[model samples]
Target chain A: MDAMQIANSIPMWVACGIPVCLIIFQSLLFMSKARQASKDIGLSDDTVKKAIRASAITSIGPSLVILSGMLSLLVTVGGPVGWMRLSLIGSVMFEGIAAGIGTQQVGVTLGADPMTPTALAMAVWTMVLCSIGWVIFATFSASRMEKIQHKITGGSTKRMGIISGAAIVACFSSFVASHLIKANADVGFYFSKNAVAAILGALFMFIMMKISAKHKKLSEWNLTIAMVAAMILTAILPIGA
Target chain B: MNKEQKTEYFENTYMPKMHRYGKLIGVIGVLVSFIPPIVLAVVFKAIPDWGKLPAAFLTGAAAFGFLWIMEPIGYFNILGPVGTYMAFLSGNISNMRVPCSSMAQVSAGVEPGTEEGSLIATIGMAVSVLINVTILTIGVILGTVVLSKLPAGVVGALNYLLPALFGALLMQFGIKDIKYAIGMLLYCCVLYVLIYLGVFSWLPSAANWLPIITAVFGGIAFKLIVDSKKDKAAAAAEKKDE
Candidate 1:
């Protein structure tokens, strides 16, 4: 093979480079904010760092395993349609995990990534893995702080109450409506991206609210709206993506 | 403790450590990006490649972009363990093509009936996925079971629920103008219609990603332009009122 051909042939590095970059970048950004948030909230740094480190370690094992799978597919079952399908699963799972069990509780969405099940499954394992560390940190570091222990909780119970009520209403409403019925899980990729974007924006607003002391109900309003919208998206969208 | 002591204790203790942890997380994140594909390539028996990077700048650039975008929206819960797990799984399935998060758009060699290791890995990944879904479904079902007990006409209530949640979330700081929301919605509908009609079939490769071509991109772009105009109008109105 020519130099170029030989070089291009090693598809794994070339292909995954962007996503990995995005992931790492995402992780670092998360870490930084977590730092700011901890400081802002008056939590101990070592605890937060420990949580992040534990999370990172827990996260990587699966990522590499998945990476191995992707390489196998590249050498086996390749195409854009398949790749798109994979992205569907990848994006949701990624977002779902980031959001926590609150997301996990939301059933399959119509617009969910075509691979939602896979993503969801990964999310379960992630939760399982991270919970171990979360418990450890909670037991030792955050023993005194009742509020902070639930940091990774994702408020699953509350979010479910909100999303399910919304979805049931939506579903029944669709049944009654003449034209605008509830479509099957039609979560487009853009929706996920937008959701991520909104969630992030709202997070900033929430942080700002906590730090400022002058709690603007408007920001709380923003948080509520964002969470609900995210839930609706979570509800009506998909089982796969 | 006195108020002064509280402030001093907080500033002296909490903030600095969080900052340091944040940096540590950032540095670790930068380092972690380079792993998955490398490991995967080796496992798949393919010759691992020299990727597009090895350049320090690449890592730095990646670090910057990720930090900026993620910092704004995250409470770190945004990086939920579940999402990462799902990502890893997607990576496994896409292994049939490319790894999850891989930049590769196409993996030319793959088709049905390839290598045993690859296929087995794919199947194994699939089974693992089924297990994951079961857990999530249980979560969903349990949630729905709770919702089932709520008051009647759930549909109508939630009709406003989405918008209500949106309003609550932004504290009414939505894409505030009804016109913009409608415009964005219409653009989405129309694009969906045309794309559904197969107009995209006629477009060239370049045109494939055309604003009119990709439903989401084109629609969002149109919406952004309209929203900006709306923003300007609102600003002008405020100025005039003042």
Candidate 2:
């Protein structure tokens, strides 16, 4: 069968469900363990509940944004593959590029024609194989990281926390700095919408934080608020072209 | 039991169960992850072109291979083992999981790496997975027609959203530790400027990695420097007391 036919096939959908179920099952087990651990550690139930609520609330906006990306993937790879990949190991950005590169290698443009089963196979292979690095590293080395970190910090969780926070800062600074590099090269008022958007996002984040202090519920929505405001700013601003 | 012994027991007894279950399910996930491709190839006799496979794999890997290695090492401290496993498996680590986990930690008033913080982060990540799956599933069921109808300008702006989000996230982190934040920002600026000035242009690949190296290692170095100063001060105080 062709890509479209296979994608819509009941068997493919069922196959997709396997990974989804595994993820859900694993998540549920972990959550329960964490919840029990929380209680054993004398954590107030209210704090745990607030975490669950805030996390869920914060995820909605980003998830919608991801939904748009998933829709685009569906246009190229069809429903089952797109759904499963997005639902499991891949994200909005990763799978599309992987599929595009896979199709390009075989001299077929994704979404340009009906993908033969072979073409579909290529996409699947690329997506699955490309993503294995994350799984492989995590599987073998994940547990070891705690030990390594403990050794590095000389058993100080506080120092480990600082190192972790610093890592995040550094990682994000690099990403933010890349935009500045792009903007620097452009030599225009706002040639890089990314830079503008990033600055605006920071602005919005500050505003949200300021407001959330008084309002409280807004804190839960800080990410969503900043992101949406920045999205609008990027749309209206004369940049990113 | 003392707090240390309790923590040890939790790590020894409870953590092993997490590892067993996580590894078991993770192995199954790895195995099942390949089913779609294998079945597609076997059932349809549509194995990919052997000649094209290497190029295709390399092309895909080239873009993401670094992230696969770096992300786990980078995020492990905050996300911990369970969060690490789930985040990598479910994907969208930087954009979705980190924010949710961090926010959860903040809202719950816990520092990451402690037992309470780790638990909260895990719960937050799991909830995010559920929410992410739910929303994406609905979008899938709704089909592309309605989704594609979203205004061009609005969709165009989505590209900037993640970049912007990252910038905001830096601020969130910066507030907690201004010294490290400033140090990291400076380190990134220096590296990026160096790359732009063509210092690393001789080795183009070096430019690609310099920012992250600056971020991870540079930040660590700054932390060490700051910590040493604090240690010195404490030691001097103790000496004075003596």
Candidate 3:
């Protein structure tokens, strides 16, 4: 099938929806859990829930907006003749951006070989990457806490989820506007796939953290070990190998 | 927790040993991760089909083995199969194979290896690279699913997630050191300027290094300029008062 036909397939809808649901679910999941955890830890449920929701909402807008922005990315790149070149351009642009930061490190820069193809050969692998990042963020947050100052008022779990979800759809739309109209470039895969997967994987990571917190499954120790092992593997591997 | 209580909690309750153990294992794990590619590159470099298999398989096995071993030793509580699989997937990325020391520098929460934290830094980079690869993989899978549903043009939009995600990830990381963050912002800025100015078509290693080097010194430069100016202004005011 042609590229246009491939873009709007059934599976795509399902994939998109899953992350949407999950993001919505995450606001609720964390709000409730934080509320419950706060109550268990002897903090007031109402207060903790409100604060958590408030903190989370700050991030919701940006996350959703960034994600939705991906939808229209393809249209902006123009028809198929240039998609590969654009994708290539994007690959280098992003890779250079990614590898060039922070320090004079010789890691990713030395190994990165950007693909000028319509698709990154091993590009699908990035979802797992984004997911792992989500995991790290979630796990770290779960384990660490700042003194919760209950300032946000009336931010309930249900309300927060709806607001975040609505905001996400809107933000996502705004971000995707260029792609939607341009009909040339696409958000490509980065917006639709990695962001969704990252949010979902991270939200789901609550289960992992909860279990660990309760001392049932993973402990801090295992996290360290796994972290080290994963670190080692990626170091010697090729870019997106 | 109160300040004292918090300090005590970190000191006693959290177990410093865990972090040290993490660092130690991380170094070894990162070291182990380097093996498959070298081995494969050496022994079976000629085989076409065998090319990806050894790298993929051996790396997967090594990642899992390292994680599994460290999990119990370090008393980690995690998702049983999920963590293993995740690590397995991450351990196998092409980018991770390049021996890039840059991964540690990329992750903010994780410190890069210098003299003090070298081992831990190495471990952290490995993990971060694997995670990046894994997340990218998931994004592509889900993105393609969307692609399959939509027309080809729409499907192409799915590719934008990496930069989007990277942007978000970097933003999150930059929160740690706002001043240092200029380096990243400048990286994008310099690249654009160079490209726009027609200084070069592609970034030479020099183009990349120059901005970052400036940014690195830029931090020190910023502070020095401000301090020196402040000192001069203060001395002038003092002289006038006298």
Prediction-by-prediction clash tally:
57, 1, 113
Residue A49, candidate 2: alpha-carbon lDDT: 93
**Model 3 Cα lDDT, one tens digit per residue, A1-241:** 3323332334333433333333223223322432333333343444333322222222222222222333333332212211211111122232222212211121222123322111211121221221232223322332231111001103222322222222222222222221212211343222223333223322333333455557732332222222222233333334231
Q: What interface RMSD does every candidate have?
A: 20.0, 1.9, 18.0
- What is the fnat score of candidate 3? 0.00
Better of 2 and 3 by TM-score: 2
Question: Which pairs clash in the backbone of model 2?
Answer: A193-A240
- For B150-204, candidate 2 gives per-residue lDDT tens digits of 8887777778877788778777778777776766777787777777777887653
Comparison by lDDT, 1 against 2, better one: 2
Best by DockQ: 2
In TM-score terms, candidate 2 sits at 0.92
Output the lDDT of residue A188, model 2: 32
lDDT of 2 at A9: 78
TM (chain A), candidate 2 = 0.90
lDDT of candidate 1? 0.31
Better of 2 and 3 by lDDT: 2
Native contacts retained by candidate 2: 0.71
Error of 2 at A80 (Å): 1.0
